[model samples]
Target: MLFFLPDAAAAVRAYARLLRPGGRLVLSTFTEVTDADKEWFQHLGAALGPYLPASPEPAPGSPPPPEARLRTQQSLADVLTDGGFSDLRFAEIAHRTVFARPEQFWDWLWSAGMRGMMESIAPQDHDAVRTALTALVAERLRAADGTLGWTTSIRFTTARRP
Candidate 1:
């Protein structure tokens, strides 16, 4: 969830302060996204570009996005060390999700975090977005065995407050 924070450094500092001396802090963040996932997001962005509001540009000299700020092991360690943590440990885990069909994948999107973006589309445009997304999924995600799979990389970090 660190990737979702607007100020991850401040959040990490607060976590450090909240823990007792020698206490452990463990957290997870997405480290990488599969090519399939990248294509999925790209298709969604293109399909929703006309309906969604334009994202605001960052102010001059502002910090990078949270995901980029702690994207690698070194960056994650740096943030924790800056927050006065030590004895850091890191692990990377990968997971793959498979859906039986395009409709199943569509349902999973509505049932998961992507629901928020889907909800933002006007009611009148839901069918259009659905049609566009489903077509893309069938073309790009379908496998010979008739399943769609996406893989993601996650990092789990453990640090000690000292």
Candidate 2:
């Protein structure tokens, strides 16, 4: 099942309450936000000036979110154990999702997490944002064939309820 739990330990404890003894729980989440992702947000912030305080990417040296902490094998295992889970296992899934056209990328940006930011942008600035975003995306992700590529790193964590 997909979970948006931000507190790894709380997530583990909650899962433990739901699962019967010896039941298994498997979940996947991102471990880190790459520099390219930060760049994308930075570009977006620039386009929507004064609308956003900062990029979505957490500031450097700040405490990482729970998902980031769970990226560490030891941290995940420890949390699971403390929450009554045993036999924890982890695996990494790396992949690239390509948008065949810029429109597809824009569609995803609007439909996915970036939707919230869209509401904050003034209607008049939409075109400008799009134009700037297109250039930014083209600079970083445009491929020889014209598709835009996004690489993702996901961690799949599996554990058995003790």
Candidate 3:
């Protein structure tokens, strides 16, 4: 949720003020994805260009995305400490999901954050997009055993207000 905030520092400071001394805050943010995942999304973006909404470019000198700002432990620590936090700790949790079929992968996409993008497609075009997505996944992500797998990483940060 912090990653979606327009001003993460402000939110962090507010949290610190709201907490009693020695109170702790635990938050999770996404880490960078694997190269394979990046490639997959590139392909997905290209394939869905016609149906998906266009993303506007950020203005020059704008603050970096919250995820990018806190992608690493050092950067996250800096933010927390600046917000009056101490005893910062970080951990990463990784998950690998394997779908036995391309249709399963398509279903997983709809079940997750990608649902927003999926919903952007006209109801009439859902089948077409699903067909194209399944074909794309089958061609690029399917393994010899015929399963599609993707690994995702999330960073959990714990900080104490002091």
Candidate 4:
């Protein structure tokens, strides 16, 4: 069966809910320390200006923007155990999505259906941020194709219950 869960905790629970006797679940999400998450957020913030905010709501529950609680792969495995899952397998995959020019970033942001949240920024500021972001990408990612290069931290784990 194919199912997608945005909520990490609930995803585990749902995993056990299905999967007949020997069902397979292919799970993919961010790892607590996948790598380069901070840089990606920084890039997004520079491009979003005030809308991004200086510091996110500093509290326990709920994760700060960009830096959500994907912390540690081991904990995810433990959560699976708690959810009555066995035969757990984990793999590190490179889901590092990167963009080159500001236009590319903007395209990804909007066309990718992830732009809804970014609408809070003023139009002018958004333009300025995009301008600055163009340079930022140019500075950071220097590929032969003139595109940015960055790595995203994603951990792909699969588990089954017997």
Candidate 5:
């Protein structure tokens, strides 16, 4: 089995060109469903009402979501077929990515493109959202070291073709 990371789609396509018949491509990636911390993002969306587009955004200092596309099983199948691959199988599972604090959470969201989405929130709501986020992290999500942990769903997709 061969393993690949994001940009894997491109890699798969490339490898398909060079792969001998019967070779396989196995891969998966991060997905938005992983945003089980939706409540936090919801707070950000509610706060950034004006600055963000119709989509949600993360608070300042947060990392934006990655640019990789989130594909459904069908989509993954299509991608594989279009890439000259066949016999596709895909599975999505919940995974936790832990952060040490609300600050750390904010940091990743900012860098993640999620921040642009959050920038639209109204300034007046920022403090309220911020406080609620802090409380949420402190009350339920924090690890022993004081970092916050959130669920991020990932899809393990694989395919083979002759």
Candidate 6:
């Protein structure tokens, strides 16, 4: 929702207006995909079918979301500044989550964009995709304790209204 704003700067200004003077605004978001995670997903997609797309295409006449553009420190700072927020600060956080069972990972995947991909596949192909992904995670991404671990980059931003 942070992205695809008609005027992201103006939206920021509107957010600033909602806060009392000297109030602080804090926002956190997933920023970039780690290379390992990207590669893992690529492998999963390849195994799924003819390379299932990560996200669906935008509707006709819809503007593309600024997912990559606003991910950097500079871009976030610029937005806060344009919104008239002061004392801006930024932080990058490394986050990790582990799933003890392969089914847990599968459940997590189906909760989001991957659900669409899974539904698009034929019934026969579904089992093969699931088996391949499960094995891939266990073999390549799982920890010694039989848990699958994943890391991602997150950005935390704070700014104060002047």
Question: Which candidate achieves the best TM-score against the true structure?
Answer: 3
Index of the highest-lDDT prediction: 3
TM-score of each: 0.82, 0.75, 0.83, 0.72, 0.56, 0.77
lDDT of 2 at 126: 74
lDDT of 3 by residue, 1-162 (tens): 887788888999999999999999998988766687789879988878887777789999998865466677777787789999999888898877898878887789889877877887888888888888888888887667766876688899999997
lDDT of 5 by residue, 94-147 (tens): 877777667566557667646765566576776665665567566667667666
Give the candidates in order of TM-score, highest first.
3, 1, 6, 2, 4, 5
Instruction: Please say which candidate is ahead in TM-score: 1 or 6.
Output: 1
lDDT of 3: 0.83
**Residue 112 CA displacement from its true place in model 4, Å:** 4.4
Report lDDT (CA) for all predictions.
Answer: 0.79, 0.73, 0.83, 0.64, 0.64, 0.75
Q: For candidate 6, what is the lDDT?
A: 0.75
| Residue runs of model 6 more than 4 Å from their true location after superposition | 4-6, 49-66, 113-119, 122-124, 144-146
Model 4 clashes, total count: 4
Model 2, 1-162: lDDT tens digits are 223455667868988999998899997766566787788667766756754445587688766644345556676778789988888788888878797766566667788656876777777777777777677667778768777987678889899987
Candidate 4, residues 85-124, lDDT tens digits: the string is 8888888866556664545766566664356666655676
Worst lDDT 10-window in candidate 2: 1-10
Question: Which residue pairs in candidate 4 collide?
Answer: 32-70, 32-71, 32-72, 96-152
Cα deviation of 55, candidate 6, in Å = 7.7
True lDDT of residue 156, candidate 2:
91
Clashes of each: 0, 0, 0, 4, 34, 0
TM-score of 1: 0.82
Cα RMSDs of all predictions? Answer: 2.5, 3.9, 2.3, 3.9, 7.9, 3.4
